[model samples]
Target: MSATFVDVEDVRQRLGSFGVWIAPMTLLTTPVATQRAQFARIESLGYGSLWSGEPPADSPMGGREAFAEHGVMLAATERIVVGTGVANITRRDPAAMHSGAATLAEAYPGRFILGIGGQTGDSPLSQLRAYLDGMDAAATQVLSETAYPRLLAALGPKTHDVAAQRTHGVHPFMQPVEHTANARRLLGPEPLLIPHQFLMLNEDAETARGAIRSVFGSDAGLPNGFYANNFRRLGFTDDDLLDGLSDRFIDAVLAWGGRDDIVSRSRAHLHAGADHVLLHPIAHDLTAAVDQLELLAPLLHN
Candidate 1:
Protein backbone atom coordinates (compact mmCIF):
# COMPACT_ATOMS: atom_id res chain seq x y z
CA MET A 1 0.00 0.00 0.00
CA SER A 2 1.22 3.51 -0.82
CA ALA A 3 0.79 6.19 1.94
CA THR A 4 1.68 9.83 2.21
CA PHE A 5 4.21 10.08 4.99
CA VAL A 6 2.81 11.46 8.23
CA ASP A 7 4.91 14.31 9.56
CA VAL A 8 6.55 12.93 12.67
CA GLU A 9 6.78 16.38 14.21
CA ASP A 10 3.09 17.11 13.61
CA VAL A 11 1.95 13.84 15.24
CA ARG A 12 4.25 14.38 18.20
CA GLN A 13 3.03 17.92 18.75
CA ARG A 14 -0.62 16.87 18.60
CA LEU A 15 -0.61 13.53 20.44
CA GLY A 16 2.31 13.46 22.88
CA SER A 17 2.07 9.67 23.15
CA PHE A 18 -1.07 9.26 25.28
CA GLY A 19 -3.78 7.33 23.42
CA VAL A 20 -5.82 4.44 24.97
CA TRP A 21 -6.87 1.00 23.76
CA ILE A 22 -10.17 -0.71 24.59
CA ALA A 23 -9.62 -4.38 23.63
CA PRO A 24 -12.56 -5.95 21.70
CA MET A 25 -13.16 -8.58 24.34
CA THR A 26 -13.26 -5.88 26.95
CA LEU A 27 -15.48 -3.65 24.82
CA LEU A 28 -17.86 -6.54 24.01
CA THR A 29 -17.91 -7.60 27.62
CA THR A 30 -18.82 -4.07 28.59
CA PRO A 31 -22.38 -3.13 27.71
CA VAL A 32 -22.67 -1.29 24.41
CA ALA A 33 -24.20 1.71 26.14
CA THR A 34 -21.31 1.75 28.57
CA GLN A 35 -18.79 1.44 25.75
CA ARG A 36 -20.38 4.40 24.00
CA ALA A 37 -20.26 6.35 27.21
CA GLN A 38 -16.65 5.36 27.69
CA PHE A 39 -15.80 6.54 24.19
CA ALA A 40 -17.45 9.90 24.76
CA ARG A 41 -15.75 10.31 28.11
CA ILE A 42 -12.35 9.41 26.71
CA GLU A 43 -12.72 11.98 23.95
CA SER A 44 -13.77 14.61 26.45
CA LEU A 45 -10.72 13.77 28.53
CA GLY A 46 -8.50 15.16 25.72
CA TYR A 47 -7.09 11.83 24.64
CA GLY A 48 -5.90 11.69 21.02
CA SER A 49 -7.44 8.35 20.04
CA LEU A 50 -9.73 5.53 21.17
CA TRP A 51 -7.83 2.40 20.15
CA SER A 52 -9.40 -1.05 19.67
CA GLY A 53 -7.71 -4.45 19.49
CA GLU A 54 -9.44 -7.01 17.24
CA PRO A 55 -9.05 -10.68 17.94
CA PRO A 56 -8.80 -13.21 15.11
CA ALA A 57 -12.45 -13.98 14.49
CA ASP A 58 -14.58 -14.51 11.41
CA SER A 59 -16.96 -11.71 12.29
CA PRO A 60 -17.97 -8.58 10.43
CA MET A 61 -18.13 -6.34 13.50
CA GLY A 62 -14.51 -7.34 14.07
CA GLY A 63 -13.67 -5.39 10.94
CA ARG A 64 -13.81 -1.65 10.21
CA GLU A 65 -17.11 -1.00 11.94
CA ALA A 66 -15.43 -1.69 15.27
CA PHE A 67 -13.21 1.38 15.07
CA ALA A 68 -15.91 3.31 13.19
CA GLU A 69 -17.96 3.04 16.35
CA HIS A 70 -15.13 4.96 17.91
CA GLY A 71 -15.43 7.56 15.12
CA VAL A 72 -19.15 7.85 15.85
CA MET A 73 -18.14 8.42 19.45
CA LEU A 74 -15.79 11.16 18.29
CA ALA A 75 -18.68 12.75 16.36
CA ALA A 76 -20.14 13.48 19.77
CA THR A 77 -17.12 15.70 20.30
CA GLU A 78 -14.68 17.62 18.05
CA ARG A 79 -11.18 16.12 18.29
CA ILE A 80 -9.73 12.67 19.07
CA VAL A 81 -8.61 10.25 16.32
CA VAL A 82 -10.04 6.72 16.34
CA GLY A 83 -8.03 3.61 15.46
CA THR A 84 -7.95 -0.18 15.55
CA GLY A 85 -4.81 -0.25 17.71
CA VAL A 86 -4.58 -3.18 15.43
CA ALA A 87 -6.41 -5.54 13.09
CA ASN A 88 -4.32 -8.68 12.61
CA ILE A 89 -2.65 -9.20 9.23
CA THR A 90 -3.29 -12.94 9.57
CA ARG A 91 -7.07 -12.59 9.63
CA ARG A 92 -7.77 -10.35 6.63
CA ASP A 93 -6.19 -10.25 3.20
CA PRO A 94 -4.29 -6.99 2.61
CA ALA A 95 -6.68 -5.88 -0.08
CA ALA A 96 -9.63 -6.42 2.24
CA MET A 97 -7.98 -4.82 5.26
CA HIS A 98 -6.82 -1.92 3.11
CA SER A 99 -10.30 -1.46 1.69
CA GLY A 100 -11.85 -1.55 5.14
CA ALA A 101 -9.35 0.96 6.47
CA ALA A 102 -9.73 3.20 3.44
CA THR A 103 -13.51 3.07 3.74
CA LEU A 104 -13.31 4.01 7.39
CA ALA A 105 -10.93 6.83 6.52
CA GLU A 106 -13.33 8.10 3.86
CA ALA A 107 -16.22 7.86 6.31
CA TYR A 108 -14.38 9.64 9.09
CA PRO A 109 -11.93 11.78 7.11
CA GLY A 110 -8.80 12.58 9.12
CA ARG A 111 -10.34 11.09 12.24
CA PHE A 112 -9.07 7.57 11.46
CA ILE A 113 -5.62 5.93 11.75
CA LEU A 114 -4.75 2.37 10.71
CA GLY A 115 -2.68 0.17 13.00
CA ILE A 116 -1.74 -3.43 12.07
CA GLY A 117 0.22 -6.25 13.66
CA GLY A 118 1.04 -9.95 13.66
CA GLN A 119 -1.49 -12.30 15.26
CA THR A 120 -0.61 -13.60 18.67
CA GLY A 121 -1.56 -17.00 20.20
CA ASP A 122 -0.96 -20.08 18.02
CA SER A 123 0.30 -19.77 14.47
CA PRO A 124 3.17 -21.34 12.52
CA LEU A 125 6.35 -19.24 12.18
CA SER A 126 6.17 -19.48 8.40
CA GLN A 127 2.61 -18.21 8.44
CA LEU A 128 3.48 -15.44 10.88
CA ARG A 129 6.32 -14.27 8.66
CA ALA A 130 3.98 -14.33 5.71
CA TYR A 131 1.57 -12.25 7.70
CA LEU A 132 4.28 -9.72 8.52
CA ASP A 133 5.34 -9.59 4.88
CA GLY A 134 1.71 -9.14 3.92
CA MET A 135 1.52 -6.30 6.46
CA ASP A 136 4.37 -4.56 4.65
CA ALA A 137 2.65 -4.98 1.32
CA ALA A 138 -0.77 -3.98 2.63
CA ALA A 139 0.53 -0.89 4.39
CA THR A 140 2.25 0.24 1.19
CA GLN A 141 -0.89 -0.46 -0.82
CA VAL A 142 -3.15 1.43 1.60
CA LEU A 143 -0.84 4.37 2.15
CA SER A 144 0.50 4.55 -1.39
CA GLU A 145 -2.38 6.70 -2.54
CA THR A 146 -4.07 7.84 0.66
CA ALA A 147 -3.03 10.05 3.57
CA TYR A 148 -3.98 7.60 6.33
CA PRO A 149 -1.32 7.13 9.03
CA ARG A 150 -0.23 3.53 9.78
CA LEU A 151 1.38 1.96 12.83
CA LEU A 152 2.65 -1.51 13.67
CA ALA A 153 2.17 -3.39 16.94
CA ALA A 154 5.75 -4.51 16.81
CA LEU A 155 7.38 -6.71 19.49
CA GLY A 156 10.95 -7.24 18.30
CA PRO A 157 13.76 -6.01 16.09
CA LYS A 158 12.59 -7.13 12.66
CA THR A 159 9.02 -5.96 13.16
CA HIS A 160 10.33 -2.71 14.56
CA ASP A 161 12.34 -2.26 11.39
CA VAL A 162 9.21 -2.93 9.35
CA ALA A 163 7.50 -0.10 11.20
CA ALA A 164 10.31 2.27 10.29
CA GLN A 165 10.60 1.26 6.68
CA ARG A 166 6.98 0.71 5.65
CA THR A 167 4.63 2.45 8.12
CA HIS A 168 4.43 5.47 10.37
CA GLY A 169 5.95 3.70 13.40
CA VAL A 170 5.35 1.17 16.18
CA HIS A 171 2.87 0.57 19.02
CA PRO A 172 4.35 -1.90 21.45
CA PHE A 173 2.47 -3.43 24.36
CA MET A 174 3.84 -5.06 27.53
CA GLN A 175 7.09 -3.24 26.88
CA PRO A 176 9.36 -1.13 29.04
CA VAL A 177 10.68 2.39 28.40
CA GLU A 178 13.89 0.69 27.34
CA HIS A 179 12.10 -0.77 24.36
CA THR A 180 10.57 2.62 23.64
CA ALA A 181 14.05 4.06 23.46
CA ASN A 182 15.16 1.27 21.20
CA ALA A 183 12.08 1.69 18.99
CA ARG A 184 12.73 5.41 18.59
CA ARG A 185 16.28 4.75 17.56
CA LEU A 186 15.26 2.14 15.01
CA LEU A 187 12.43 4.23 13.55
CA GLY A 188 14.80 7.19 13.50
CA PRO A 189 13.55 10.78 13.88
CA GLU A 190 10.61 10.53 11.50
CA PRO A 191 8.21 7.73 12.51
CA LEU A 192 5.26 8.07 14.84
CA LEU A 193 6.28 5.98 17.86
CA ILE A 194 3.51 5.09 20.26
CA PRO A 195 3.67 2.37 22.93
CA HIS A 196 0.83 0.99 25.07
CA GLN A 197 1.52 0.66 28.79
CA PHE A 198 -0.55 -1.25 31.34
CA LEU A 199 -1.86 1.04 34.06
CA MET A 200 -3.13 0.81 37.65
CA LEU A 201 -3.57 3.14 40.64
CA ASN A 202 -2.96 1.34 43.91
CA GLU A 203 -0.21 2.48 46.26
CA ASP A 204 0.26 -0.80 48.06
CA ALA A 205 2.87 -2.43 45.86
CA GLU A 206 1.66 -5.99 46.26
CA THR A 207 -1.97 -5.07 45.63
CA ALA A 208 -1.10 -3.24 42.43
CA ARG A 209 1.20 -6.01 41.33
CA GLY A 210 -1.42 -8.71 41.95
CA ALA A 211 -3.91 -7.05 39.61
CA ILE A 212 -1.31 -7.06 36.84
CA ARG A 213 -0.33 -10.66 37.47
CA SER A 214 -3.92 -11.85 37.26
CA VAL A 215 -4.22 -10.34 33.79
CA PHE A 216 -0.73 -11.31 32.69
CA GLY A 217 -1.08 -14.94 33.83
CA SER A 218 -4.04 -15.34 31.53
CA ASP A 219 -2.38 -13.51 28.58
CA ALA A 220 1.31 -14.43 28.87
CA GLY A 221 1.27 -18.03 27.69
CA LEU A 222 0.11 -17.20 24.17
CA PRO A 223 2.27 -18.61 21.36
CA ASN A 224 4.02 -15.29 20.93
CA GLY A 225 7.14 -15.22 23.09
CA PHE A 226 7.22 -11.43 22.78
CA TYR A 227 5.43 -10.65 26.05
CA ALA A 228 7.08 -13.32 28.20
CA ASN A 229 10.55 -12.75 26.79
CA ASN A 230 10.19 -8.98 27.15
CA PHE A 231 9.33 -9.57 30.79
CA ARG A 232 12.51 -11.57 31.28
CA ARG A 233 14.52 -8.87 29.51
CA LEU A 234 13.11 -6.42 32.04
CA GLY A 235 14.36 -8.58 34.92
CA PHE A 236 11.23 -10.61 35.65
CA THR A 237 11.97 -14.29 36.29
CA ASP A 238 9.69 -17.12 35.19
CA ASP A 239 8.90 -17.76 38.85
CA ASP A 240 7.47 -14.27 38.92
CA LEU A 241 4.95 -15.39 36.28
CA LEU A 242 3.75 -18.62 37.96
CA ASP A 243 1.75 -16.95 40.68
CA GLY A 244 1.25 -13.23 40.23
CA LEU A 245 3.30 -10.14 39.53
CA SER A 246 6.05 -9.51 41.98
CA ASP A 247 6.34 -6.04 43.51
CA ARG A 248 9.71 -5.52 41.91
CA PHE A 249 8.44 -6.72 38.54
CA ILE A 250 5.25 -4.68 38.57
CA ASP A 251 7.11 -1.59 39.72
CA ALA A 252 9.35 -1.99 36.71
CA VAL A 253 6.63 -2.48 34.11
CA LEU A 254 3.35 -0.93 35.24
CA ALA A 255 2.41 2.68 35.85
CA TRP A 256 0.61 3.00 39.18
CA GLY A 257 -0.09 5.34 42.12
CA GLY A 258 -1.71 8.79 42.18
CA ARG A 259 -2.46 10.95 39.16
CA ASP A 260 0.89 12.65 39.32
CA ASP A 261 2.66 9.33 39.70
CA ILE A 262 0.95 7.80 36.72
CA VAL A 263 1.55 10.91 34.64
CA SER A 264 5.19 10.87 35.60
CA ARG A 265 5.52 7.28 34.46
CA SER A 266 3.74 8.10 31.21
CA ARG A 267 6.18 10.90 30.69
CA ALA A 268 9.06 8.48 30.90
CA HIS A 269 7.86 6.92 27.66
CA LEU A 270 7.48 10.28 25.92
CA HIS A 271 10.92 11.25 27.04
CA ALA A 272 12.16 8.00 25.58
CA GLY A 273 10.71 9.07 22.16
CA ALA A 274 7.17 7.74 21.94
CA ASP A 275 4.99 10.06 19.87
CA HIS A 276 1.87 8.70 21.63
CA VAL A 277 1.25 6.70 24.77
CA LEU A 278 -1.70 4.28 24.52
CA LEU A 279 -3.06 3.80 28.04
CA HIS A 280 -4.63 0.44 28.96
CA PRO A 281 -6.07 0.66 32.46
CA ILE A 282 -5.85 -2.53 34.44
CA ALA A 283 -9.47 -2.64 35.50
CA HIS A 284 -12.68 -4.44 34.54
CA ASP A 285 -15.26 -2.00 35.83
CA LEU A 286 -16.08 0.67 33.27
CA THR A 287 -16.62 3.21 36.01
CA ALA A 288 -13.29 2.31 37.53
CA ALA A 289 -11.56 2.78 34.19
CA VAL A 290 -13.20 6.17 33.79
CA ASP A 291 -12.07 7.07 37.26
CA GLN A 292 -8.52 6.23 36.25
CA LEU A 293 -8.93 8.53 33.26
CA GLU A 294 -10.22 11.26 35.54
CA LEU A 295 -7.18 10.83 37.70
CA LEU A 296 -5.02 11.08 34.61
CA ALA A 297 -6.77 14.14 33.14
CA PRO A 298 -5.24 16.69 35.45
CA LEU A 299 -1.78 15.50 34.49
CA LEU A 300 -2.47 15.17 30.78
CA HIS A 301 -4.58 18.24 30.21
CA ASN A 302 -1.72 20.57 30.89
Candidate 2:
Protein backbone atom coordinates (compact mmCIF):
# COMPACT_ATOMS: atom_id res chain seq x y z
CA MET A 1 0.00 0.00 0.00
CA SER A 2 2.82 2.37 -0.68
CA ALA A 3 1.54 5.74 -1.98
CA THR A 4 3.31 5.49 -5.31
CA PHE A 5 0.46 7.15 -7.19
CA VAL A 6 1.05 10.56 -5.64
CA ASP A 7 3.81 13.04 -6.45
CA VAL A 8 4.31 14.42 -2.94
CA GLU A 9 7.24 16.63 -3.79
CA ASP A 10 5.34 18.32 -6.61
CA VAL A 11 2.33 18.91 -4.36
CA ARG A 12 4.47 20.52 -1.65
CA GLN A 13 6.23 22.63 -4.26
CA ARG A 14 2.88 23.90 -5.55
CA LEU A 15 0.94 24.42 -2.30
CA GLY A 16 3.72 26.19 -0.33
CA SER A 17 3.21 26.92 3.40
CA PHE A 18 -0.15 28.73 3.61
CA GLY A 19 -3.57 28.73 1.93
CA VAL A 20 -7.17 29.96 2.44
CA TRP A 21 -10.31 27.80 2.92
CA ILE A 22 -13.39 29.88 2.23
CA ALA A 23 -16.72 28.15 1.69
CA PRO A 24 -17.11 27.81 -2.06
CA MET A 25 -20.88 27.73 -1.74
CA THR A 26 -20.71 31.37 -0.64
CA LEU A 27 -19.58 32.29 -4.14
CA LEU A 28 -22.28 30.15 -5.76
CA THR A 29 -24.94 32.61 -4.61
CA THR A 30 -23.11 35.56 -6.10
CA PRO A 31 -23.06 36.53 -9.74
CA VAL A 32 -20.66 34.42 -11.81
CA ALA A 33 -18.58 37.40 -12.92
CA THR A 34 -18.19 38.61 -9.35
CA GLN A 35 -17.22 35.13 -8.21
CA ARG A 36 -14.49 34.99 -10.82
CA ALA A 37 -13.23 38.41 -9.80
CA GLN A 38 -13.06 37.43 -6.14
CA PHE A 39 -11.13 34.23 -6.90
CA ALA A 40 -8.72 36.20 -9.07
CA ARG A 41 -8.26 38.67 -6.24
CA ILE A 42 -7.41 35.76 -3.90
CA GLU A 43 -4.73 34.57 -6.31
CA SER A 44 -3.28 38.05 -6.38
CA LEU A 45 -3.18 38.13 -2.57
CA GLY A 46 -0.31 35.60 -2.49
CA TYR A 47 -2.13 32.70 -0.81
CA GLY A 48 -0.68 29.49 -2.18
CA SER A 49 -3.89 27.46 -2.34
CA LEU A 50 -7.69 27.85 -2.16
CA TRP A 51 -9.56 25.12 -0.24
CA SER A 52 -13.34 24.60 0.17
CA GLY A 53 -15.47 22.26 2.24
CA GLU A 54 -18.22 20.25 0.52
CA PRO A 55 -21.52 21.04 2.19
CA PRO A 56 -24.64 19.05 1.45
CA ALA A 57 -26.63 20.45 -1.48
CA ASP A 58 -29.90 20.31 0.49
CA SER A 59 -28.39 22.32 3.31
CA PRO A 60 -29.56 25.92 3.77
CA MET A 61 -26.20 27.20 2.60
CA GLY A 62 -26.77 25.65 -0.87
CA GLY A 63 -23.66 23.58 -1.46
CA ARG A 64 -22.47 23.09 -5.00
CA GLU A 65 -20.87 19.84 -6.18
CA ALA A 66 -17.17 19.94 -5.17
CA PHE A 67 -15.78 18.95 -8.59
CA ALA A 68 -18.01 21.39 -10.45
CA GLU A 69 -17.04 24.15 -8.06
CA HIS A 70 -13.37 23.22 -8.37
CA GLY A 71 -13.63 23.36 -12.16
CA VAL A 72 -15.22 26.80 -12.05
CA MET A 73 -12.76 28.16 -9.50
CA LEU A 74 -9.77 26.63 -11.29
CA ALA A 75 -10.90 28.19 -14.56
CA ALA A 76 -11.43 31.50 -12.80
CA THR A 77 -7.95 31.77 -11.31
CA GLU A 78 -4.54 31.63 -12.97
CA ARG A 79 -2.07 30.10 -10.50
CA ILE A 80 -3.51 29.44 -7.04
CA VAL A 81 -3.93 25.69 -6.36
CA VAL A 82 -7.59 24.74 -5.75
CA GLY A 83 -8.70 21.76 -3.56
CA THR A 84 -11.54 20.26 -1.58
CA GLY A 85 -10.86 20.84 2.12
CA VAL A 86 -12.71 17.54 1.96
CA ALA A 87 -15.31 16.03 -0.37
CA ASN A 88 -17.36 13.51 1.55
CA ILE A 89 -17.18 9.95 0.19
CA THR A 90 -20.60 8.79 1.36
CA ARG A 91 -22.29 11.38 -0.86
CA ARG A 92 -21.23 9.62 -4.04
CA ASP A 93 -19.93 6.26 -5.15
CA PRO A 94 -16.19 5.72 -5.51
CA ALA A 95 -16.32 5.35 -9.31
CA ALA A 96 -18.04 8.70 -9.65
CA MET A 97 -15.57 10.35 -7.26
CA HIS A 98 -12.60 8.84 -9.07
CA SER A 99 -13.84 9.83 -12.52
CA GLY A 100 -14.57 13.36 -11.37
CA ALA A 101 -11.14 13.74 -9.76
CA ALA A 102 -9.47 12.27 -12.83
CA THR A 103 -11.33 14.66 -15.12
CA LEU A 104 -10.27 17.66 -13.05
CA ALA A 105 -6.66 16.53 -12.91
CA GLU A 106 -6.59 15.96 -16.65
CA ALA A 107 -8.10 19.35 -17.33
CA TYR A 108 -6.31 21.41 -14.70
CA PRO A 109 -3.08 19.41 -14.35
CA GLY A 110 -1.08 20.39 -11.25
CA ARG A 111 -3.59 22.97 -10.05
CA PHE A 112 -6.12 20.45 -8.60
CA ILE A 113 -6.02 18.29 -5.43
CA LEU A 114 -8.87 16.01 -4.39
CA GLY A 115 -9.36 15.55 -0.65
CA ILE A 116 -11.89 12.87 0.38
CA GLY A 117 -13.58 12.10 3.69
CA GLY A 118 -16.29 9.84 5.08
CA GLN A 119 -19.17 11.97 6.38
CA THR A 120 -21.27 9.20 7.94
CA GLY A 121 -20.51 5.53 7.67
CA ASP A 122 -19.66 2.35 9.54
CA SER A 123 -15.94 2.03 10.13
CA PRO A 124 -14.59 5.08 8.33
CA LEU A 125 -11.23 3.45 7.78
CA SER A 126 -12.68 0.38 6.10
CA GLN A 127 -14.98 2.51 3.93
CA LEU A 128 -12.07 4.74 2.85
CA ARG A 129 -9.93 1.74 1.97
CA ALA A 130 -12.67 0.37 -0.26
CA TYR A 131 -13.16 3.81 -1.81
CA LEU A 132 -9.47 4.10 -2.65
CA ASP A 133 -9.49 0.61 -4.19
CA GLY A 134 -12.36 1.64 -6.40
CA MET A 135 -10.57 4.87 -7.25
CA ASP A 136 -7.51 2.88 -8.36
CA ALA A 137 -9.60 0.71 -10.68
CA ALA A 138 -11.35 3.79 -12.06
CA ALA A 139 -8.06 5.60 -12.58
CA THR A 140 -6.71 2.89 -14.89
CA GLN A 141 -9.63 3.55 -17.22
CA VAL A 142 -9.83 7.34 -16.89
CA LEU A 143 -6.26 8.44 -16.27
CA SER A 144 -3.43 7.68 -18.66
CA GLU A 145 -0.80 10.36 -18.13
CA THR A 146 -0.78 11.29 -14.42
CA ALA A 147 -2.68 10.48 -11.26
CA TYR A 148 -4.25 13.28 -9.27
CA PRO A 149 -2.82 14.03 -5.82
CA ARG A 150 -5.33 13.33 -3.03
CA LEU A 151 -5.68 13.76 0.75
CA LEU A 152 -7.81 12.10 3.43
CA ALA A 153 -9.84 14.04 6.02
CA ALA A 154 -8.07 12.17 8.77
CA LEU A 155 -7.68 13.09 12.49
CA GLY A 156 -7.18 10.00 14.67
CA PRO A 157 -4.24 7.62 14.54
CA LYS A 158 -6.00 4.81 12.64
CA THR A 159 -7.28 7.20 9.98
CA HIS A 160 -3.86 8.80 9.74
CA ASP A 161 -2.37 5.36 9.20
CA VAL A 162 -4.81 4.71 6.36
CA ALA A 163 -3.94 8.07 4.81
CA ALA A 164 -0.20 7.47 4.98
CA GLN A 165 -0.63 4.00 3.51
CA ARG A 166 -3.10 4.87 0.75
CA THR A 167 -3.15 8.56 -0.19
CA HIS A 168 -0.84 11.51 -0.65
CA GLY A 169 -1.48 12.89 2.87
CA VAL A 170 -3.96 13.77 5.57
CA HIS A 171 -6.04 17.01 5.72
CA PRO A 172 -7.04 17.35 9.37
CA PHE A 173 -9.68 20.08 9.79
CA MET A 174 -10.48 22.04 12.96
CA GLN A 175 -7.49 20.58 14.82
CA PRO A 176 -5.15 22.25 17.33
CA VAL A 177 -1.34 22.62 17.19
CA GLU A 178 -0.79 19.65 19.50
CA HIS A 179 -2.85 17.51 17.12
CA THR A 180 -0.72 18.82 14.28
CA ALA A 181 2.45 17.64 16.01
CA ASN A 182 0.91 14.26 16.81
CA ALA A 183 -0.41 13.82 13.27
CA ARG A 184 2.98 14.66 11.84
CA ARG A 185 4.53 12.04 14.08
CA LEU A 186 2.08 9.43 12.86
CA LEU A 187 2.21 10.53 9.21
CA GLY A 188 6.01 10.55 9.32
CA PRO A 189 7.97 13.35 7.58
CA GLU A 190 7.47 12.81 3.86
CA PRO A 191 3.71 12.73 3.44
CA LEU A 192 1.77 15.98 3.02
CA LEU A 193 0.25 17.26 6.29
CA ILE A 194 -2.05 20.22 5.61
CA PRO A 195 -4.01 21.12 8.76
CA HIS A 196 -6.76 23.76 8.82
CA GLN A 197 -6.47 26.72 11.24
CA PHE A 198 -9.55 28.84 11.99
CA LEU A 199 -9.00 32.59 12.17
CA MET A 200 -10.98 35.63 13.31
CA LEU A 201 -9.67 39.15 12.67
CA ASN A 202 -11.67 40.97 15.36
CA GLU A 203 -9.43 42.89 17.80
CA ASP A 204 -11.80 42.68 20.80
CA ALA A 205 -11.48 39.49 22.80
CA GLU A 206 -15.21 38.91 23.35
CA THR A 207 -15.98 39.74 19.74
CA ALA A 208 -13.45 37.18 18.55
CA ARG A 209 -14.76 34.57 20.99
CA GLY A 210 -18.27 35.27 19.77
CA ALA A 211 -17.10 34.76 16.19
CA ILE A 212 -15.53 31.42 17.15
CA ARG A 213 -18.74 30.30 18.84
CA SER A 214 -20.84 31.35 15.87
CA VAL A 215 -18.74 29.40 13.39
CA PHE A 216 -17.85 26.19 15.29
CA GLY A 217 -20.66 25.81 17.82
CA SER A 218 -22.41 23.20 15.73
CA ASP A 219 -19.34 21.01 15.42
CA ALA A 220 -20.09 19.46 18.79
CA GLY A 221 -23.21 17.99 17.19
CA LEU A 222 -21.62 16.78 13.97
CA PRO A 223 -22.40 13.10 13.37
CA ASN A 224 -18.75 12.20 13.18
CA GLY A 225 -17.09 11.63 16.56
CA PHE A 226 -13.74 13.01 15.33
CA TYR A 227 -14.02 16.56 16.72
CA ALA A 228 -15.08 15.62 20.24
CA ASN A 229 -12.49 12.87 20.47
CA ASN A 230 -9.70 15.11 19.22
CA PHE A 231 -10.65 17.78 21.79
CA ARG A 232 -10.51 15.21 24.57
CA ARG A 233 -7.16 13.94 23.31
CA LEU A 234 -5.91 17.53 23.58
CA GLY A 235 -7.02 17.45 27.28
CA PHE A 236 -10.28 19.39 26.74
CA THR A 237 -12.89 18.30 29.26
CA ASP A 238 -16.63 17.88 28.53
CA ASP A 239 -17.08 21.24 30.23
CA ASP A 240 -14.79 22.76 27.63
CA LEU A 241 -16.95 21.40 24.81
CA LEU A 242 -20.10 22.95 26.30
CA ASP A 243 -21.43 26.53 26.48
CA GLY A 244 -19.97 27.68 23.17
CA LEU A 245 -16.60 26.05 23.85
CA SER A 246 -14.44 27.03 26.84
CA ASP A 247 -12.25 30.10 26.41
CA ARG A 248 -9.12 27.99 26.49
CA PHE A 249 -10.49 25.55 23.92
CA ILE A 250 -11.59 28.37 21.63
CA ASP A 251 -8.19 30.04 21.89
CA ALA A 252 -6.43 26.77 21.17
CA VAL A 253 -8.49 25.96 18.05
CA LEU A 254 -8.79 29.48 16.67
CA ALA A 255 -6.39 32.27 15.79
CA TRP A 256 -8.07 35.53 16.85
CA GLY A 257 -7.22 39.11 17.82
CA GLY A 258 -4.92 41.27 15.65
CA ARG A 259 -2.94 40.34 12.55
CA ASP A 260 0.09 39.33 14.60
CA ASP A 261 -1.98 36.94 16.66
CA ILE A 262 -3.36 35.21 13.57
CA VAL A 263 0.08 35.00 11.97
CA SER A 264 1.58 33.61 15.15
CA ARG A 265 -1.06 30.88 15.37
CA SER A 266 -0.50 29.90 11.75
CA ARG A 267 3.26 29.86 12.30
CA ALA A 268 2.74 27.56 15.27
CA HIS A 269 1.31 24.90 12.94
CA LEU A 270 4.26 25.14 10.54
CA HIS A 271 6.66 24.94 13.47
CA ALA A 272 4.64 21.93 14.73
CA GLY A 273 5.54 20.12 11.47
CA ALA A 274 2.69 20.96 9.12
CA ASP A 275 3.75 21.19 5.49
CA HIS A 276 1.06 23.89 5.05
CA VAL A 277 -1.73 25.50 7.05
CA LEU A 278 -5.10 26.25 5.40
CA LEU A 279 -6.54 29.39 7.05
CA HIS A 280 -10.31 29.37 7.49
CA PRO A 281 -11.12 32.96 8.38
CA ILE A 282 -14.41 33.44 10.26
CA ALA A 283 -16.52 36.35 9.00
CA HIS A 284 -20.19 37.06 8.44
CA ASP A 285 -19.68 38.25 4.90
CA LEU A 286 -17.54 37.02 2.03
CA THR A 287 -16.05 40.47 1.60
CA ALA A 288 -14.98 40.50 5.25
CA ALA A 289 -13.28 37.13 4.76
CA VAL A 290 -11.42 38.51 1.77
CA ASP A 291 -10.43 41.56 3.84
CA GLN A 292 -8.92 39.29 6.46
CA LEU A 293 -6.97 37.53 3.71
CA GLU A 294 -5.68 40.86 2.50
CA LEU A 295 -4.42 41.72 5.97
CA LEU A 296 -2.88 38.24 6.32
CA ALA A 297 -1.12 38.27 2.94
CA PRO A 298 1.86 40.30 4.14
CA LEU A 299 2.40 38.06 7.15
CA LEU A 300 2.23 34.65 5.42
CA HIS A 301 5.40 32.90 4.30
CA ASN A 302 5.63 32.87 0.51
Worst 10 contiguous positions by lDDT, candidate 2: 215-224
Tell me the TM-score of model 2.
0.93
Q: Which residue runs of candidate 1 sit more than 4 Å off their true CA positions?
A: 1-5, 58-65, 68-76, 120-145, 217-224
Question: What is each predicted model's overall lDDT from 0 to 1?
Answer: 0.70, 0.81
RMSD of each: 3.7, 2.2
User: Across residues 1-302, which tens digit of lDDT does each residue of candidate 1 receive?
Assistant: 23454555665665645777765656666666776777778877888877877655654444334455555555655567877777766567766776677777676667777787755555534454565466457657564455667777877677777567667777787677888888888778888877888888778776677677666563453222677766666566866644454566667678888777888888899899887888888887766777788778877868
On lDDT, the candidate that comes out on top is 2
TM-score, predicted candidate 1 vs. hidden true structure: 0.83
Q: Once model 2 is optimally superposed onto the true structure by TM-score, how far is the C-alpha of residue 55 displaced, in angstroms? A: 2.5
TM-score of each: 0.83, 0.93
- Expressed as tens digits, the lDDT of each residue in 188-232 for candidate 2 is 999899999989988888888777676655444222277888778
lDDT of 2 at 284: 65
